[model samples]
Target: MWCWLYFYIFLVISQILYFSSLFFLFKVMDVFIEFQILCFNSVNVEMAVFLDWVSLMFSSFVFLISSMIILYSKSYMVKDKNLDRFVYIMVLFVLSMMVVIMSSNLVFVLLGWDGLGLVSYILVIYYQNIKSYNAGMLTALSNRVGDSALLVGIALMMGLGGWGYSSYMGDFFLDMNLIMFSVLIVLASFTKSAQIPFSSWLPAAMAAPTPVSALVHSSTLVTAGVYLLFRFSNLLSRESFMVFMYLSLFTMFMAGLAANFEFDLKKVIALSTLSQLGMMMVIFFLGSEDLAFFHLLMHALFKALLFMCAGVIIHSVGGCQDIRYMGGLVQAFPISSACFGVSSLALCGLPFLSGFYSKDLVVEVFSMSGMGLFIYLMFFFSVGLTVSYSMRLLIYVFIGQFNVLSLINLNEKDSSLMLKSMMFLLVLVIFKGSILGWMSFSTPYFIVLPFSMKLMTLLMILFGSLFGLDVLFSGVGQSSSMFGFIHFSLFVSGMWNLPVLSTSSLNSFTLNLGKLYLKNMEFGWAEFYGSKGGFNLISMILYEGLSVIRNHLKIYLLLMWGFLVFIVLLAIV
Candidate 1:
């Protein structure tokens, strides 16, 4: 009955050993081992395994988080009849991520990439509800754009003679094919990571189970793009980096702003995930791949725990996801509330937490760089927005008045498995960053800044917390200005009309085109020129032939006799 849990436990033990060994190996030497399964004349068509410290570390984290989630789901989804199927799909999801992590060849990368996409769609619609169906569609279509870009990348890679992108790193060929490939790769990353226009689906995909959300948003689906970009960092053009830096920064700001305006508990976290992903991408484009990866690993640990905490809260509230209906959960479910607070604070990059290590390093590194004022201001501003939303989430969920019925049971101890999984990650969320930072970077980055510059991040967090408090208290009882406030809230909370743009605006035109196609092609043209038209034309011709034959038979005999007499007379003459 608990076979799945046993498998996950085995995976966790194996990954911990792998991570520790790989960490040491990475310190002593650079390890890049490639195994080829198939080879042709000059072109390699075989599935290959690429293992190094980076891939191994990421893979270990993936298994670690996955095992925790599966263990968590044992209690979270215990009542569901299809528990085995759920476990199976979760296994496939983890396996697909592993394939992507281990493969250097684009062919196998695409295989795993597509697997992630396909399996994600399946998971998104697992609830079999209308919302899940719509979310799945949005998720699928948004990712298809990335899939197309990768397919184009594969085509361009053929001109470069092989699918192994690892070999092409640092050897940037300034040719059209290479340039195009790099652009396509960035495009692919943008979609997979839910950048800008693709941002809507990440929030919508919250229709999935919270365990799936934790897995997808943290280490698997959304992070897949960041991982891909991390691998292809060297292949990217400076121009592409410059262009996408602004885009990724804008995406970060946008998601943070939206999260502050959002009332739905799960979506606020989803938007926060989007914001962090954008932060990772922007830093990567700004010439700090190591820091970005560091942030990514740190993020996965806490964000997954964050979602799990939210799941426990949601379950206790009897599936009500509206934070407006929730308040003072700290008193009811103290363990989950404490875990949620820790995770949210980590999200805000509070001092000494896991998120702070990478986030602080990112800030120091950016300040040290010679970027322009727009980049500098926007980066910190977005960081403030991050704190703002986390404050807003915490206030709405933990400090506000509890609006639910008193009869509801909000006990945390009942779900001991869930609590255990969360506590395991809870420990990491507190200390993983320092451990990871020490291990990943051989030497420390010595940042020298003015006193004012060093205090900027803390200042932003303080300002953001105040801003969140103001927003929460502002709209309480102002009926006169409520209309304008509602409109403003709608616009911001709707992600600046991105969901409409992605779904309705784009869909309206396509849906109309489909209607036109149905009317003209399937109905009008086919009816007039196809089987119906042919049948009618044949029937008319046959009727005319039969009528002509019947009428001509009588007249022809008379005419023939008269013609015969005239011919005989002429011959005689």
Candidate 2:
């Protein structure tokens, strides 16, 4: 399995076997593979696995994509001396993600959840550079918020029942503090999924290897939050759920705008990933868990392929990641360029592609659900932006005058490991949509809307294409002049700088509070009025009084005698 093609084959077989196993069972089943050692009294605290069509499909896709990434990394990281360590970290990330996917026990999920946080931090800083360190810290701390929220949510869930997911079924809903339980779960999901305020970390995490970015953005870390919320669908639908839905809308909009302005190849893709996550959250909130999960799996396939294609371009171009420094790449590397083209169009929800299947359904569901107009507008605008940036990316890199230094030779790496991995995902990028649409829905989502509103999606797709073509022809568009609004560009492109806000704002307050505590409690009041001060005062009095008494022994004796006589007289009276 360590061999390049061997791992892909093994993963394919495992996916087939696991998916096939689900058919023999007639109904939903929760399987608890318990560890007796972890149990205490009635709280068994077991390794519980939930088996359903959703779990099977998502888990299978995770492993399938992970196997492809491992093969891709074998070639991408072949030059690094620590390739072994990189592989180990990637393996651990997969295991952690599997735990999240398969475990029904909340504690077991945390085990995997924390594993993702810790390992992603390690991977993000794998470059061992200061930038990577800062990015890793932002990623870790931002996700820490979600992880802690999950912990609190888990504790809150215990009020209703045990920590296993199945415990939330039946009479559990009657016992819960609905507000706290629901809100905490949403907050946790928001952070993990990088909805709005927690979004800065997702882009920052692009400092990791492209494979890690592909894994994190596609199937692993970021998706953990959405998957979790889906798992807790019973606990999440409420008034508070609308708050996250709006946040997701803003995220989708913000990321779409940012990806258009971003010059970095990887960062652009990262923002694109963020926007799609927003779409998934909306699908979940709209009461379509099946559609959300379906999009998630399909997104994992195409997005991974997209990043892998980007990796090839980045590697072949002598590590230059800025799109401004690249152009006419289709002439040089036709194969890689073709893969990227398919991946980008799929991202834009080009008809008959993977994204088209789930994305179109999401929009249709929104039209018929009687939701507010604002949500519908934001979603379509983001979809337009999706195509705009994708077209902008294509124009900048694949179709234009060569924008490289004349002396620097450029050609395809032709690494078979990389090519084969991309080819595998390319197949999915083309076919997975149809496969998932058929498998996930026995009957299509039926929605009735006027022709004008129904054509909104198509119109936006057209408008976004034209905008992208304009961007392509605009003469190597500078980052500063992007979107024709510099300030808004910076605001959106920087993800509202939430990374700095989340980290610095939080750290600043905590630091100030610490200083106040040290000054007043530790140094001032504790020193003067606490035990040490009292002991010191008593010791000084004893020393001074004892010396005076020794020097004036007769006077001291007279005083003691008078006091004793007074006490005796009072007693007699």
Candidate 3:
């Protein structure tokens, strides 16, 4: 059965590769085709496919990363009894992302959008535990907000008599309807991308199997929002752009800060994904859609690779995900360690790697833009935070002493297929930067900046590395000043108590409201006046009638006997 599943995965990979290559050619030829699938005459319902470089290239990258994830999952989930079901659900998830990527109509986009939310909920709760259930609920409910926003946007578009991408274009800034629609689109994107207040779900979503995390954080689930924004970039008003721009910047800063304090391996990676997503949104709003999309693709490559490596390490460590319990793994798992290190470097935007090309461009572009001093320094500082946490990850997992129990088994040899999948992405993480950069940008961006401005990025990286080392050293029983530091760590690591705010705080209020409703409606006045009151009244009336009959029983019987005798005599006469 496992062999057959492997064969199936390889077959799917080959087919996806063939189509992706074909799509690449289509992209190169600058071809655009719209194929109408169905049209309704009376209500004017229509379904059509929009083929272009944007959709095709995005689809190709999504498919490529999904293929690797599936390959990795074949071995990663081989021991599971529901492996077949897992594979099927994963494929369905990928197909839904394809629909979102290729559809130009808002209605179909919503359809695909809802599909992603539904299937992701399934994947998140696949373990059928309380944690998974909670995570699934958070993931679904957060995306549901986006779904509603899209529904409202579609309804708003109905006034204009079209649901196509072009319908959202004209008179966007002046017309109230168009501006409202644009706001709805931005709101939908925010929820789906897990931006700002919606961000608690991203780390909570780590309850899912690692493969799902890789696919989700990289290409399908979270990217759906950014892609939606990319499609509607031209329609966004300056006010909306500026508002979200600052929010996205804060998201980057917050996630980077949180990752340094986090101990869970998967969640740290999840936070990194959020940080990168914020960066994408920031660059997108800065008037470089191409750079945003470019970064998205590059991010997908290395992030997927990063998650896969994390998965391997987690699997080898007897399901341990805490980096504190994981140390000195490099000697036990050489290949996985190397892949993880390279992916981390790529994530830190090491020069010439896949991430550097896009990240450097983002920094250069942000520097070139006429922005305020605070945003500028905060942006670079956030970049430094990224390096700090990544270095912390390396130090904890590789350079530190072995911290796990001696009896725990650790093996890397059996995960041949998993390693192979990692190798595939490792190659991409190394070389895909230049390839994608050239393909994405027809002409390079020439930004002339002062030396100090250009050197700031490197300086931040160095400072961040030193900070990471400081974090390691400071962790050694430094009890003199831990009181305030502990409180601060709790705030940042807990995403400023967002999980509690989004879940527990709101939940407590809602549950209290429900209890009050139950008391008032069912146990209070409603019960007293409705069925319970009626039953009591009927019982009281019956009790009174029975008492009166018992009191007058003797007299009533005598009267009845006398009347019977009189009636008998009259009949005889």
Candidate 4:
């Protein structure tokens, strides 16, 4: 009971801090813009000293999303036995995310980064189930690897005499290792963002509660990578740029493919998050920092909205998350279905929606960079896949005939207040780009819209919609037995095709080399002599020797005493 009380108190304090910090951030932005106006003519004033446009924009999104998630959690988590614990960790997670965005110093940023990771792990395992616990452990372990890279990057920055944000901004031009550190930082970002090999953990994290999934997986937490990259854009090197470009493109394509195959509603969103992160990375890599930031903001809004909607659907359906088990939910749950459809449209990059502006901006920037062929093709394909899977989600859960109505006692009521918080997010997803024009970091780059790019987006959406339509008309079928065989083959091949060389072989070679060296030297027997058992034998021999020495010492002391007594007698005489 005391623990519960303290947990509630902690939650209250955290919420207060988070909102207070957000208020301060807005104030800071106002002051910063004013300062820029007043000091534009002054040679002493530096733009970096104030909250830059990019930071201000991203911070606003962070604040908004964090606040919405907090509000939503209240109702979503009601009646949960671990309500206090959940509230406590959720608040801390939001607090850390806010700090990560607002902090000017790298050390403070890292503090927030690590704190967020820790809190997320706790939340992932809040259910204390074996599956959730394993998911949490895996996430924590992957994050640790990322954190180590970040720490090394920080160390490199410090070694170059960069102790604070001011120093980094002032000496950025002079620091040669800044490029190396920037590369390391991007590696950390990729891991945290859950790209490629590290991404497997994210889908597994669906084992977490929906609110945790909604906030952490879809919005604020995954955005941390893009945030870090944006934060350190000035120091990004050419090599790092290429690396990010390739990796982002690859991750985007692979995640899209994975999403196409996913059956679980949450896993689909999880993979979509990975794909979206990849798109954001590509934007950042192309030096379109403003566009990237806009994408990040748009992504947070729509993705979180979608996740919350999924949560509501899952809850209404008696915890049946398999899309196949759901149908006609649109008729049953109009409000949730509407919200989900809107968010999905945005996610699919539909025209005039939140995703279109941001995602199009990324594509526009890619084309302008003259490396358009591969990047555009990969992203184009992924966009189609996005539409396909999103439609699958919509039709599977919201369209088709009502099959699970009896199971869930289907109602037509709107989602709870917890789920309603997503409505605000939906509004933002629709209007954020217009509210904040493509954010400029150094210089505002004019976004050129191409007919080809617009056409490609439309075509992808059309194809995806058609595919979804086909599925809806044809009705759900038992996915071919061929799929199981394919999975088995992939698993077997992946297991057999060891990506890394055998450690046993390497160890055996080293042992053979050691044996050869020992044969070359007559005193190679010294190794055996220095073995544990040999050491024990030597110690026993030393013990015997020490006993003899101790006896001799005792006799010498007695003789010395006798000599001293004789000398005393002579002196007395």
Candidate 5:
């Protein structure tokens, strides 16, 4: 009882602090406008760092979303035994995210960047189960690889006469080395954003608790990589720009494809999040940084709401997460079903929702970049895939027949008011973009026509939905064989064709060359030291060679000893 009381008290305090900080952040923004402060003077003599429009916008989002997650978590995590530990780690996570957004120096930025990753890892493994622990470890390891690349990129910038964050911005475009640094930075961003190969860990990360999923995966942490890319957009090279665009497009397509096959609820969301981040990456690479930033904000709102809704469903159903196992839930849990539907439409980028505005803005940016027909067509295909998977999730979870009624056992209670605080997030997902409009940032692309591209896109979505439903419900596309022989042959050929050097071959060549010269030198040290068989074999050769030399040197040693004795005798005399 005391534990519960303490938990509630801490939650109340956290909520107050969160809301107050958001209020303070807004006040700071208002003051900045009133004072007409364009830039700040450098505080450090060694490194010049400036506060700017981009940093300010990111900082505002980080603070606001972090606060909202905290409030949402308080209710979401109400009954967990480790509520105190959860809150503590969560607060640190928010603090680190804020620091990442606000820090001007690369060192400080990295400090926050790494700190957030660490806290998130701890939170993910908070359940202390084997699966969750492994997932957390994988997440940390991948992020560390990204962090190392980022650090190297920063070091390269510093070596090129770039002092810190300030030198990477305006007027610094003349530096040639910025191109190399930007390439490395993009590599780092790809890993952190979970593009292609690095993306496998994200769906695995669904082993974590739902709040961690809602907070880290959905809203803030995943966006950090894309934010970094946009932050240093001016320094990006043409090669790196193409690399970013192509990789992001490929990842988006692949994630959508994978999500269509996924049955796990959180994994579906994880893949969908990956796809959305890829879109943002493409937008940023195409010189639509502001639009990407805006989209990122909108993505956070709906994604978090969706994840939270998933959390509620999982909790109510006693931890059944497979979508195929869920159905007829619309009649059983009206509120959750409604929230899920709204969030699904938002994820599908339906008009008037937050996602629709941001997603359309991204498409418009891509269309204007003169990238040609191929790129645009690829993006259009990705959009169709996105709709397919998202609708698959909606239909399977809420609208279909309840296939696993025994698993859920309807007597289980609905979530409490604390859990339901997530409804506010749903509300925001529905109206935030329309209510605020695009003026505060830039006006969103408003494309108008009769049989317009937007209408065509909607038609594609409808087609995708029908196709996905047919595949899921009617078994239209089901296959018993996981891979055909031709596909397996191609996969093997692809792996064999990868350009990595064969380490075993190189090692064998070197060993054979050494053995020719040292054949007679092998003997004895293995026996003397009682070493492992392999080590003993090598040691014996070294010992035999040294022993032979020592034996030969004994004659010289005797001569020197005799001369020393004569010299000592003469001195004594």
Candidate 6:
């Protein structure tokens, strides 16, 4: 308790200092400090810290959200015996995230990168159950792909003669291996951000405690990928840019579909996080890394609140994670319900909220870009689908029938920890848009549009909202005997079987193949010929050499005669 209090105080002070620096000190000059650590053959290895407006602001946001998560975990993990360990891991995770935020050296970023992955794996399996372990493995291995790619990118970056990103920022165009470097970095970001095939693990990681989910999914780990891409946006623009755009679009759409179909509360939020990550990636691809960064920070604020509010609901429902088992929770936990409702609105880009400021800017920016119909359709359609799922979720959680068990203790008592943390985030979720919007960017974008174009986002949002409410209100999140729609539902709701393809189905196939290999090769042929049986056979042959030789005497004589003839032929030649 005291620890969280001190940590909260530290973060509050840290955020103030950062805000002060951004407004005052950084306006004069940036801070770039480095310590030379090693040298080899005229090559210098240094630990570099670069704090300009970006780092200061981002680090402050991270700490702000982190302090809230730590406080939230106090209530969330109150019953767990491993509370201290949980908080420790979260603190370490935040520290790792800060390292990623503050460092100008790619190597230091990797240290934080791997640290986030490792600590998240630990957090995911904190429950110590088979489910948690499996989820943890999936999360870790999926992340390992990105980590390996990042290492390769670092190796390739070394070819440019240094590992410090600040030195190479303006020279991205002159790099000889720009394509390879960009591809590797994009690939790394893709895995870390849970894009496409790597997307399964983010939802799977919901097996962790809710606090960890809020911390990991909100601002720190998944956003690490987008942060990397933003930092290297200059380097990734050539040739491979369209690919990231398409990937982000698909990820956004897929997550929206899956979340609409999902019954599990945590998984829905998790998929929404996946969708929002895609949104940020798309914004980054659209040539406004600053706006993307803006959305990233805003997303962290509201998404953290969304997950925490969901946690309070999950807790109130006596650990019931299925939204079908939840309803009328608003009547029991009004504050949590309020927080969830607002955060979901913020997530759906409600006007004047934290999400609105960045999301509106992104849509307007894209509209002005004169991009193709494909880009416009993908962005707007995904926006609509987002509203669809958000409405669907609201129906299941707040407006639908109260389907929870009658005997379950759904009380409003003992929400102090959750309420305190959520209330803090709630304030940020409301005002951070205006606050950061003013602080981060000075010039407002000029967007002139026709009437239809102006109403596009709203119309799409309305369509998706009606579509989601109509379908889900008719009982989608609840159990049904409608087997006809099952396949279509599975395809759409399961992300076209994406998470299954990436996780269960794929794992099953690989495990079966491994079993077959063990049966046919390792345990079958190798065991037969390379083990005790083969040894016995060799021993028998050695012991019965005279008898075996007598039986094969005619064959041996023929072989000797053929050998002699061959030798004679060779000698004659």
CA RMSD of all predictions:
5.3, 7.5, 4.8, 8.9, 8.9, 8.3
Candidate 2 regions exceeding 4 Å error are 1-13, 21-42, 406-409, 471-487, 511-573
* Candidate No. with top TM-score: 1
**Each candidate: what lDDT?**
0.86, 0.82, 0.86, 0.70, 0.69, 0.83
lDDT of 3 by residue, 398-462 (tens): 88988976535577887898999899889989998988777666677999999999999999999
The TM-score between candidate 6 and the true structure equals 0.87
Model 1 over residues 1-573: C-alpha lDDT tens digits?
Answer: 563665567476647746664665566645455666666767767566766678878888888888888888888898889988998898899889888988888888999999999999999999999999999999999999999999998887775667888776544474567778888898888999999878999999999999999999889999999999998887777776888988899999889888878889999999999999999998898899989999999999999999999999888888889988888787888888899999989988888999999989988898888789888888898899888888888878888877766546688867898999899999989998888877778677899999998988889888888777767767633454322443477688888899999898988988999999889988898888997899999999999999888899777888999999999999999
Q: State TM-scores per candidate.
A: 0.89, 0.85, 0.88, 0.74, 0.75, 0.87
Per-residue lDDT for 1-573 in model 5, tens only? 433444455445445544543454445432221122223353222322344555555555455455556665666677787777776787677677766665555666777789977987887788889989877887787788788977887666564444355544664567676677777778777777887557756776788778778877654678888877776676677666876688889888777766777678998898889889989988888877877887887888788878878887887777889887888777766777788788788878888998887787677657657677887788877888788887888888878888765744452154655345567777878887675344434444555445566465777688778656655664423353232332243232222222122223435778886776455334344334444566778888999988878887886788899999999999999
- Residue 210 local lDDT, model 1: 92
Write down the worst ten-residue block by lDDT for model 4. Answer: 493-502
Residue 262's lDDT within candidate 5 is 69
Candidate 2's displacement at residue 284, Å, is: 0.8
* Tens digit per residue, CA lDDT, model 6, 1-573: 744774667578667856765774337557889998887766667899987777777777778888888877877788888788777888889889888888888888889999999999999999899999989999898888888888887887776566887787667667777888888888889999999878888888999988889888888999999998887776674678778888888999889877878888989999999998998888787788888888898899888998898888888777889888887777888888888889999998999999999998888888887878987888898888889888888878888788888646676578797898898889889997987777667667778988899899999999888778766755543444233453467677767666678777768978999999989988887888788688999888887886767779787888999999999999999
True-vs-predicted CA distance for residue 158, candidate 5, Å: 2.6
Question: Ten consecutive residues with minimal summed lDDT in candidate 3?
Answer: 476-485
Instruction: Give the distance in Å from residue 570's predicted Cα in candidate 4 to where it truly belongs.
Output: 35
Lowest summed lDDT across 10 adjacent residues in model 1 is found at 476-485
